[model samples]
Target: MSQIFDFSGNEEFYHGGSIYSNPKEAGSFLSLGIVNHVDVYFPNKRARISAPLVPGGESLEQKKQVSLDVLPDECLYEILRRLPGDQERSSCASVSKRWLMLLSSIPSADLCNKFEVVAEEGDEIESDGFLTRSLEGKKATDVRLAAIAVGSGGRGGLGKLTIRGSNSVRGVTDLGLKAVARCCPSLKSVSLWNVSSVGDEGLVEIANGCHRLEKLDLCNCPSITNKALFAIAKNCPTLTSLSIEGCQYIGNEGVQAIGQFCPNLKSVTIKDCPLVGDQGVASLMSSASFVLTKLKLQGLNVTDLSLAVIGHYGKTVTDLVLANLQNVNEKGFWVMGNAQGLQHLRSFTISSCRGVTDVAVEAVGKGCPNLKQFVLKKCAFMSDNGLMSFAKAARSLESLQIEECHRITQIGFFGLLLNCGPKLKALTMSSCFGFKDMILGFPLPNKSAPLRSVTVSNCPGLGDMTLAMLAKLCPQLQCVNFHGLPYITDAGLLSLIESCDAGAGLVKVGLSGCVNVTDNVVIALAKYHGGTLEVLNLEGCGKVTDAGLVAIADDCLVLNELDVSKCAITDFGVATLARSKQLSLQILSLSGCSMLSDKCLPFLVKLGQSLMGMNLQNCNSISSSVIDMLVGRLFRCDILS
Candidate 1:
């Protein structure tokens, strides 16, 4: 008899089998004394053949049947890569030793280039292995950045790393900047806010290594000096945007270096750099670095010479900010008036520049023909003449902010209200003491101005008449902020709330610090126009209580942000206020309110995942546990408490 051979369907090839058949096709009718199984038939005389009956036993069969191992490693790697985030991938890595080994071998996982470790309180520094892995014994010249949360995470292999913490990043003796200098061939952007320890050497190290760095924001990094800046000019040729906002040590040397090396520089913000002078600025402009489109020289000692340089070569400037440049005088304006190529200018902000008069501003108005935004704050010398000049030339203006310019009287702004040809969309004027009822008396357009939004805060002189006129004239007004407007009582707001819209579209109203505003107007607003009102800011309205809030909650289902901080409300009031079922509140600022501690927790927690931002600053009653409950692990909070 010929040796019987058992066949396996799963195998790609059969072992020691002369013929094969499936059981489903075979029938007992084909042969007697046989089950419904396959049988092989031979046409010629049978020949003797010797073969193993069951091949190489069960173990061989088991090994051959495992088809998962037969799939390509690349395919398996792709499958792993498709998983979301690290925690899920880490779980897959733990399934088996083979999976662990395979996952470890993946180049994407092996590189481990970007790691952010946010430290929780009581989490021991020794337990953080991620920092050790990132900083120790790695050779990656192409590595870009390794960001670690302050108060946690180690300074690892140092290619390019950003340390964000409450404490200053001191000399990296343990995991210091030397590691970055040694390993990182290129470092680009470094931001260290409130970091006190980073001195001149560490900054110099980054400047030397990161040749292609474009933006360097050292906000409040006070120890940085001209020496470090000199190194940056020598090493980083592509540096464009530099902000040393609070660095006191920077002087003329730093400015000269920026002019020489980074000729194509665009944006520069140097606030509170006391040593900067007109000569340094002149040197910067004379270096043929005319490509500067944005320049901010705040809190510097720049004078007429600096202004002349800017007018000569910086005609291509788009956004020029000279806030607190005390030395800029009326002569500077004459030079700026002759600027020929400043046609593309869009935004200009000059705040606290006491020397800037109507002359300089008028020159700016004339020179920059395409100006779209003009913000002049604390320019005490600015008057109606300057504002009229700006309004006449900047007919294409869209947004304007005039803050703390006490000299710009109501007559100045009335020019915009009456004769200005441009249609304004947004306007903000705060602390302008010259604002009076004359602004309201200005003749409205035959069809009213196309004003949509207006914010007039700390303008004490703007009386009720002005508010009424704003409501009547700006028919399309959708939002208004009348903060700290003491004279605007409920009478003005009543008119506004009643006539905001004939049927629909009135959305937001901010009446914070309006001392005379009462609950009657707010309640009336809630009852009549609740459907359209989305944001209501009644902060510091001492007279508003539960009655107004309950009415708002019951009526205005679309209310998203309700700033009733400093209002006279209890826990019950907060609960009643937040009871609106369809309210999708994203930001809630209840700062300075003593009643919103444990009282508002249950109601706030009911918001669940809908609330994204909340400000509980100065709220003395809120405990830490409430914060933990509201935020959980996914909280990205900005707390200054």
Candidate 2:
């Protein structure tokens, strides 16, 4: 008997070109000793395929069609999870919408572990063993961030994330950060810049989730406050570096919490945070269980009390930078130095601080016995007496840089050179109005100074005599940079270079903006130090011509970087350089050389074999098409046209 079943209530079903609205119709089709099958798919449900028996109690044998769409969601997810690479999974997802949903459901942590396993098998992991991702402007959206939270797991764990300047309408908010926090537990460093949409909630989530975070930088994030910082202090115990800038809401309480909780903190930088005061600075310096090695405080409201605390408690500090502290006076620096706790300080920078006077300078020199590098800028009160005294007292100082110190005269400058220890290897002075070419009765140093680098720039008062004096004092100079000194003629530079020791050849020579410098200086440099010269900058020296370029090409075999912007060099010089078989030039800048045209493009292309970067801005004779052609030919070089 052919048992008939009713299918009238169900929707129309089709099989083998037959529409079977009821069981009787379906029975007729089945009566031919053929098994009829119907495949149905339901949304959010497992797919099912059913077949009915024939009248003779026999079932028709047929081949079943199988595909990813017909598979169960759990099965599909497992298949996607087992895929060895992100590219493979991505290819699968592109097939249909169902695969994409399944792929997104996989746990990112598991994917990260699987990726690590694969990396270990293939030996593809980098030495750092980390992945970095950045989101900026329109890209800083919750959907994209969520994708990163998931996709980054498949390649390698996300170790660093940077979010800069979010979209004004749909910027990254707590939701995006929360997604990151939920998935990327391996995150070690995070930087947020100008992201006003993210607030304390997002940061708190990160702090609670990424306990291994070692560095955090927040700049211009107005919404972040003490709450987020406090949360981080309590949760991120291994935090080693922290920088907060332009966050008005962050004050002493947040810093105090960090000082009290984060015992392993190594570096702290707080800039333009007006609310920070003495208590916060004191706590950060005195409350830390371990010695802080670096501290930078700028544009803060803290006074001398903070400096005193730092001087007393910062026994192991190696680097300290204090700038624009209007409230701090000479008394504070004097007291801090007199305390003598900066015995291990190696590098110290003071800029635009009223406290950097003669008294404070001498105190610092006498106090920091191990100080090796000192940089003073815009210290108007610092005169020759204090500089001379500092030179005499700082026996261990090896590098001194003075900028815009109008009170430092030629007498003090000479005294510094004479009194500073023989270990002083670098001296940089710029924009000092007090450095006048005055006759000095004191005898020059009896022996050649051990100074290897000297840079003097933009000092109208400095002249040929100053360079002559420098040449007499330091005969073993390896790097010389003189800029914007119109008085420095070829005679001065020639004297300096000729005095250099033969064995210690000049490695870098920069005479940019020295209008008085002509091809003679360049020719002298090529003849005397070209074999060892690696970097030569003659930018703005309009008097230089192709002769200098020819000399450099002929002699500077190892020269890798050369800048001759605004010079009088033509195609002849460029062609000469291109034909040089020995020149290993990597970086070339010919900006503002209007004389150069399409004629020089071929020559530059020839030189681009080993060149990594080139700049030809303002070369009007060369059209954009030619520049584009040059760029195409030199695919590996970065061209700034």
Candidate 3:
């Protein structure tokens, strides 16, 4: 019965006598990682006894299997507090009366991410800003505001509001924004996409009301201008982030107003505004007080002066994106190099600036210690020396894109991968003819890192083994685009699919101009990765026939976006796709498929409400009457013939 006895000293354990004698032998046997069962014996007396029952898994697991009778309310509350607010909390709240009672007692803020306001289908807000018509026919913003009004006073303690619209709902004019302004006072974030009618009057009202707004996105709202920006700065002083894209009338004045007023503005993205210029950028650098962490400006006419201002003031800038700054040269970049502010630069993108050369890039590489994304598109003067210098210096660079940079050779392009290949996640090199076969699949001495995305489209020198090598090395790749590689055959495509984790991870595969691709590669794709493939484009693959189409329809149940333009497929193949009940076919292109006729139209309507855009541009068989019929019947889907 001694507690401390080695196995060597215990003779009974050696002979399989009683296992309960020495506790040390039993503890040692149990410590050997036994899971299912353990054996301990007594030779003199034979007996069959059941072992102690182990605790079960976490399907409602808590202290003693989550029994309400066994645990106190405090312990139950603590366990529920650890559960995630969304699904786990909801599931626990639904389990029993006791759980429901406890969940009701917890504070709503701790139990939820954000109180959401979503307008139900067929629910409409009346012109007078009242809820009516199932809340469907009214403008999306109005209905959301009405929901906030009806829920818990105005605003309903709402933190996030999303008002998405279509043709059925009325356009979001000034009235809708005013409704949101009146109802949602605590709004912190708002996303307005596809609404063109929202102008300065409505935005001014929103700015006047939503003082606590931290994030505002006016993407595709082109009508707003300087007055609205001035109003926003005056009202929303706490605004930390703002995005204004595709706003036509917004110019230097609005940028100046935003910079002068919003002191806490940490991030600003002004893209596609042709009117913004160097003056606006200079004012921004001067008045914003250089507290910006992210800044993206496009379509701005700026010279070396703008770059100098940015380098001088933007010490805390992490992402600096400037496009169409044509006059910037080596001197501007050299001035920026001395700023010491760029030491924390993460993303540096300068496109359409042909004046930038290797000197600018070297200057940037020396200062940007944590540079992750380096993109220089249409920078004609950039060469191999500049690229290698940046690549060698910025050790954390994960993405490298060099488009239309004609001076880069294999030494620069491949040398980048040779040094930074282990950490590179995305590599896009297009129109670079100097990139050839040997560099792509060349073996590295160390373990290869998996790239998430790779686009070598229009690079003619790429050989057949390049894809196979990528298949072996980059298994996590989601998008592989070799759009104009005419010589690619089943060898590369098949190796790509088969080598992946059964090809289930691939999301988008583009082989548009791959003339040699045939049904064999498609069949391999359908066999392995049918469930996960989303966008499959074989636009110019002339060899794929009806058999391949049917195979894709049968296997690729989740495939929605497909383009078989100029392929060898006929009406019979398309009819098979039309009959597929599981596939949610959305954007389809049958352009240049000479064999497809009007018979395919009836089959296409079977897609019901899901089909959005259908292009039949070059099909000679479809009549004008059929096109008219398509326009009439499929009002929701775009028809092009």
The list of candidate 3 runs beyond 4 A from truth reads: 1-261, 267-287, 296-309, 334-338, 421-423, 433-443, 460-465, 578-584, 605-613, 624-641
- The candidate, 1 or 3, that scores higher on lDDT is 3
Please estimate how well model 2 matches the true structure, expressed as its whole-model Cα lDDT: 0.84
User: Model 1, poorest ten-residue lDDT window?
Assistant: 144-153
TM-score of each: 0.66, 0.82, 0.57
Q: In model 3, what are the clashing residue pairs, if there are any?
A: 122-134, 122-136, 123-134, 123-135, 123-136, 124-135, 124-136
Measure candidate 3: CA RMSD. 25.9
List where candidate 2 sits over 4 angstroms from the true fold: 1-129, 578-581, 597-602, 623-629, 632-636
Model 2 TM-score, 2 decimals? 0.82
Report the lDDT tens digits of candidate 1 across residue range 1-641.
Answer: 11223533334343444353754233323323221121222223332222223245321112212223433465455454445544654566556545554554343322233244457653322222223212222221112122221111123322234444332222222124433432333345555555555577866766654466666776666767798889888888777777777777788888888879887678777778778788777777777347778888888888888877787777668888887777778888668767655677788888887767877777777787777888888888878887887777667678889888887776776666654545667889988887776443444667676677889999888877777777776767788888898888888878777767647656888999997888897888787678888888989998887788778777886888778778877778768756777667766667777776675778766654466667777778888777777666425543333
> Candidate 2, residues 458-558: lDDT per residue as tens digits?
88888888888888988889998888888889888899889898687999999999998999999999999988999999999999999999999898878
**Global lDDT of each model?**
0.66, 0.84, 0.71
The candidate that wins on lDDT is 2
* Pairs in steric clash, model 2: none
Candidate 3 residue lDDT tens string, 1-641: 13312233324434444456885665555444342242222233322223343245222212222234344575566566555433555566567656655654454334323343347654532122222121222455443443343232222344565554423555556765665565445667666665666789878877876787777777676678888888888888888888888888888898888888889999988887778777988898788856788988776667677777888788778899977766677788877776666777788888887657888887777777778888888887888888877777777788988887878865676556555635678989888776556644455545454577788778776666667666766667777777788656899888888877754477777888888999998888777888888989999899989888888889997888899999998889988988777888889998999998888878767753688999889899988888888888998899887
lDDT of 1 at 419: 45
